[model samples]
Target: MRIIEDPRSYALVMVILASFLTPFVASSINVALPSLGSELGMGPFMLSWVPTVYLLAVAVLLIPMGRLADIYGRKKIFQFGIILFTVSSVFAGFSISPEMLLFFRVIQGIGGAMIFSNVSAIIFSVFPPVDRGYALGWSATGTYFGLFFGPTLGGFLTQYFGWRSIFYFNVPLGVLCAYATGRIGFEWREAEGEKFDLRGVFLMAISLVFVLVGFSSILSIYGFSLFVVGMFLLYFFYRYECGCDSPLFDFDLFKNRTFTWNGFTTFISYFAGYPVVFLLSLYLQYFHGLDPWMTGIILSIQAFLIALASPVAGKFSDNKSPRIIAAVGLFIIILAMVIFSFSGFLYWIILGLVFMGVGFAFFSIPNSKLVMGAVEKRFLGVASATLVTFRVLGQLIGMALIVLLVDVYLVGGSVAVGPFRALMTVSFILFILLLLVGLVLTLKAR
Candidate 1:
């Protein structure tokens, strides 16, 4: 009598939908920042917080939520996250001030962490490793599909219906995702009897908050002190978790070199990659005189290619060695950064997008597969969350760098060629060095 008979199909479909919606929320805001700034009374520096707060919230919660999913049921937490994300979107849409909007954005980030931390774990629980690559690839493809449309649709909504419409627009789609999640009809609780580490969670949260806030304010002596304190607290958390029988984190997972190296590359890759996407919207619109619609289309190309390539890459990795595929992907990303660093021409930018798109697609699946496969099935939730945590942290730090450079150099929201070029040059140097490090790490990963 059920329309969806197979549990595995339900799992895949639901995860893909969740994956699409969450990233759409994240990526859509980039195109709407100018509109948000204008209407919300925010300056360039303050605009950075629009995305940063959401990411910060997710980064801090992912590991804890992952552990909770293992101890409780992944399904229950996932469903709650989607409803929370959906409700927060509505609240964000109706916000009367920047403060109100940020509070809701934090709520949205918490929901996103809950939803994302469980997705790969769910898939891993439902499918064997041989089949997981294909499902994960398709689900990641869905995420790229969201990334592809996020800017384009966000720009359209902001241009015609106003920026608030971007938030309001998630309502129907979010409701649909939540409904689908319920119908998944299966629960995964691998560590059902394990005790939740409340102290570890508190320590982790404060450590991350200090580290991120201090990273943003790093030009100050106070910020430097906070950063040092954060690092010490992180060490304390590490020491504590290693000794706990029912730790919130799985410290033993990193004993596998493949997992460690793959996680490092994930961190480095996103750290170097996303700032370009974040800043390019401003450049295309303010400096080059493109409208939001045109700018979205320009930005959407890379994700489109990423969507196309991910499934194929996933399948390819299943049949052969992923080492060359991953290395090639990293090299292409470095190459794309080279093109971006030197030129702002439309032709060159398109070329760079082409290379970067394929590169990202090729690199991601292999890295994900390695990290996910290295751990035992019982620790899948933690492994998945750790992979996502690296990604979110990398993205958070990358965006923070943009805010810091923009504040130090540029005067306001509008983009200027001189300042933009200066940021690009610095970003490229850092990007390329990290890419090389990631390459070395990937080659040595198992």
Candidate 2:
């Protein structure tokens, strides 16, 4: 007879496996973007849709799905997510048109939302308070592992096989994770009897789609109008959720200062940093005259450092204050962003990537610990989903910003000093502001 894995061990293993799948697909695709564009015959605006659409779907659905996981069962939802992701990958690999590829990407995003929103909650549910940070750190290491190999391996795959091969790669890994989660022989249903907030879900989905679409298309009058309508709906959604007994999102979580700041700093850090890889991929390829393989290798450097640092940071958060750790990490990211602003050579870029790795390692795991630590046990699903939502939203906004900035500012895809400087300057200011906010949170944590 086979011996069953311990629940905590099972949860950690399964969560890490699932965590690894999303970023592996994502980063690998980032490596493949140039090739995908060329082969798909996509122009700049349509090309931007390739990534943005996936993030948009994930952002819109995260909260509702997290709540659903809480009421139903995390194990059930996670398994479904894995299957969905696996199937979508197969379809995405065979996409003949840009629209078809984007359609499948949205499906993959929904699956990703389901998987990510629950992974932390499942880990938190199974692991003890004392072990939570270290467990989470390990989970983060899985993420960094994906980041580490996505570009490196993704580059190799893209260069040798083709862009389509990247999506094909996620299938077996997703299936393996689904099997791992199933074998855990457990389910978490913290809010089992609670009613699902269908109205709230509808409002949020509509609002986010409009807002992201609008912001992404800000240069156009129609985009501006959609954005305004989205903001209005979002405000209405927040007010409605506040009054609900079983709201999809518990706005009250923000009342805890630590949770609030954790969310804010998380969003800010990601908003500032998420686009770096995308931009650098473009910069290295278009401006520096590097190939996709070399570009991917250089970009993988930051992830390598993250892989090294995440577990240590997670363990550190267990003993020391996570707030302080996150603050330091944010500061390091700011420094790196500043360097990026002035960087014209490869060495400076390498140094900046190293700083980014160090800073992100310090911040991500610790901040995740603090956020989960601050929430009530029953709300873990929502908390986990919210945190991931901030992260994905930040990425969505970051990519949108890059697309808008590049379209309006860059002439013929050239990363001249003018547009590049403007974009970095904006990113720098955002980071500095976030750094100050982090300091405030640190003091409060103390």
Candidate 3:
């Protein structure tokens, strides 16, 4: 009855709460990385795995979880995810070794995957097409808000309470969301009778693990071999899914030009953009000689601007062409990357970050709406998962790119601007390519 009265409100609340917690953990943990390393007696490579394991776990599980949500019930999976996340956070806080911490992080990632895959679908289910962008924009704002505050809050907690406090912090929020899920008082079992594709899921998991690890370790023979194996497995997955009665991924979705192009552009946008936060976190702490708390305050600006701009961009998306709006955003991002390449001034670099925020805000919401719009209601879960998967891939690849650049140019984590500049240059080129391709797609669609 409550859901029927205001399904949008219930769904949004659940999504925003859960969504906020994840990014808060994600961005904030960066500030605590050094402390984690020192306390855990972890080297730089092992320290990297703290975040890497979580990301890899989430990326691999997102699609499968979404399929499960679609087949069983979105609410049930989401509730379980929140509980798992909360439990894992507690375990992470209590971890005695880097290995233990990474194991907990992997659990957190599983929870994250369940949450990410379904939230967009749940929101889209409740809101009508015309206002879906508005809802999604608000959802984006929640995510940015988490990112916006993660560093600042995480820094403060890490400074005063210790790095483990950052993990402990997630507990109350996750518990609250777990409670809230019951109040939502409804279920969406869209594919209740469908059989899940277990083989397809196994293949996907294997492929993603290989691909993600391969990219992360890119400069190594093992990395290349893993990548090849992953690709081979992925190709087989595609072949198998194509003929299945209830395929994990519906290949027919690709036949829709808008969906395909939207997916592609989304991939590129993330590939071009996801590196900024990671790079800046290190740049501020290591290169600029800033403390964790100070670094957090500065880094929070980009996400702050994104939170401010996403709703406005989402509103415009309803009435205007999302492609044009997103393209303009891409252009701004390119300009920002170019500025990042050459700028030496802190204020100048901050200015570029502002541009980055505004650009992502404009690109993300409208693009999300467009992608959701392209798919049918029945396939919303898969579509949302697929979209997020591209984003996760972009983030992974961007990290890999940074790793490659750093390994090649920087010796023992020297804060040389050259590697940063080179990285931005590569990003600038990617955005430019994205812009050109987007233009062609827009024109073709018209």
Candidate 4:
């Protein structure tokens, strides 16, 4: 008979499995977007809101929920988040209109925020420092695999079933994950005398919503005015954070040069990397006329590379400065984006996807180690949440900026490969900026 092992390790596995579900939801939706729009009578401008609302809601709530996880119990909130996410998926599947779907998507984002905010912290807390990289690598594997499978699953469902089937796919997985979490016994020691930063929470939420909404509208109407309002809200949020006794975002983290620079570098990297997946999926279906299942298989190439590379990169970060590792990754991504800009052939696109997957794996795994290492264990939740917030922000901004540029250049209502080239060119520029920032940060880290 097999002996039962450490319960915490079991918990970590469960958490990792649960983590996979959200990305599955996110990436799969991208493939189904066009079909959903046609079936629901959604305008191009309005269709953008599906992903935008989910991202905005997640970004807005990350810090607040992270604080709650720390003060209460991570396991408790994380489990609840899984339930909420499952329920929301069911609701989203049944949505009759674009507006209804957007509402349910926002709800799903909130659930995702709660689950994600505590993940790194919980994993770190459960594993020893020497083995943290290995543990995280396993977790990253789940995440990357989900990313790989998301589009493929979405495509298959959309082609064989209906777009709604993509949402329905979550129900069985969610129930299993919830059961696993419940069975895994983890102890929670609550913090006493910790007060919630209500004011900071409100200001941060308002600021994040304003920023995301403003950016999302940049290609549409009233873009500049919305951006101004977002800027104003951020100004006030900074002021509020500075004054709070227990701020939602600990400004003190900025003093650590490693944390600050790594955080910024991570933001830039994801800004360049994340949006391409969705944009490429759209291009494949709308422009190249690929079937949904084929599109999913095509997108999976990048995800598979990331899954394979991240663990090796994470291990390498332990023995060396992450500067070289991360910079090299960014350089590879820049090269891939450039290749994509010039090549319209499917084989070239596949080659670029492979390079991008490897690059992202190297950049993400090591960068995560750097950020977590910079902060104390006590503040791990906040640090993790802060990094995620920037990542979500980068994705939001990247999507908005690309859509705006594509809209301005394409002129046609339907999306095509030419617009994607323009978008990839912009992605190349962002990767160059990321490379520069990574180099500077690595030097500062030294």
Predicted model with the maximum lDDT: 1
List clash counts for every candidate, in order: 0, 0, 0, 0
> How well does candidate 2 score on lDDT at residue 255?
80
Clashing pairs in 2: none
Q: How do the residues 1-446 of candidate 4 rate in per-residue lDDT, one tens digit apiece? A: 22236666566677668768888888789878899999999988888788878877888889888888877777777788889999999999999998899999999999999888877877777777666666666677778888888877778899899999988888988888777678767744344357779988888888777767777776556866777788898898888888888777778889899899888888877787777777677777877889866887898888898888877877776667677787777778877877776776788889999999998877787777778778876677777788788788787777777777767767776555666667666666665666676657755674
lDDT of each: 0.86, 0.84, 0.82, 0.79
Residue ranges of candidate 4 with Cα displaced over 4 Å: 1-4, 33-47, 96-100, 159-161, 188-192, 219-221, 278-296, 319-323, 341-346, 411-427
Q: TM-score for all predictions?
A: 0.90, 0.90, 0.91, 0.88
Instruction: Between candidates 2 and 4, name the one with more favorable TM-score.
Output: 2
Give a tens-digit lDDT track for model 3, residues 1-446: 66545756767777878879998998889879999899989999898888878888889999999889888888888889999999999999999998899999999999999999988888887777778778788888889999888877888899999999999998988887787787776788778899999999999999989888887776789999999899899999999999999998889999998888878878877877777767777767766888866766777788899888988988888778877887777677777877776664678779988998998888888778778778877787888889999898977786678777777667686656676666556655665676567646643542
Q: Judge candidate 3 against the unseen true structure and give its global Cα lDDT, from 0 to 1.
A: 0.82
Cα lDDT of candidate 4 equals: 0.79
RMSD of each: 2.9, 2.7, 2.7, 3.1
Stronger candidate by TM-score (2 vs 3): 3
lDDT of 1 by residue, 1-446 (tens): 46377777778778888989888878889889998999989999888898888988888999899888888988888889989999999999998899999999999999999988888888888877678777878888989998888877877898999999989988888888777777776788878888999999999999999998888778799998899999999999999999988898877777889999989999999998888877777778777899866777888888999999988888877776776678888999999999988888888988999998999988998778888888876687788889999998888788878888888667776567898778777878888999999999999888
Q: Rank all candidate structures by their TM-score, best first, as comma-separated numbers.
A: 3, 2, 1, 4
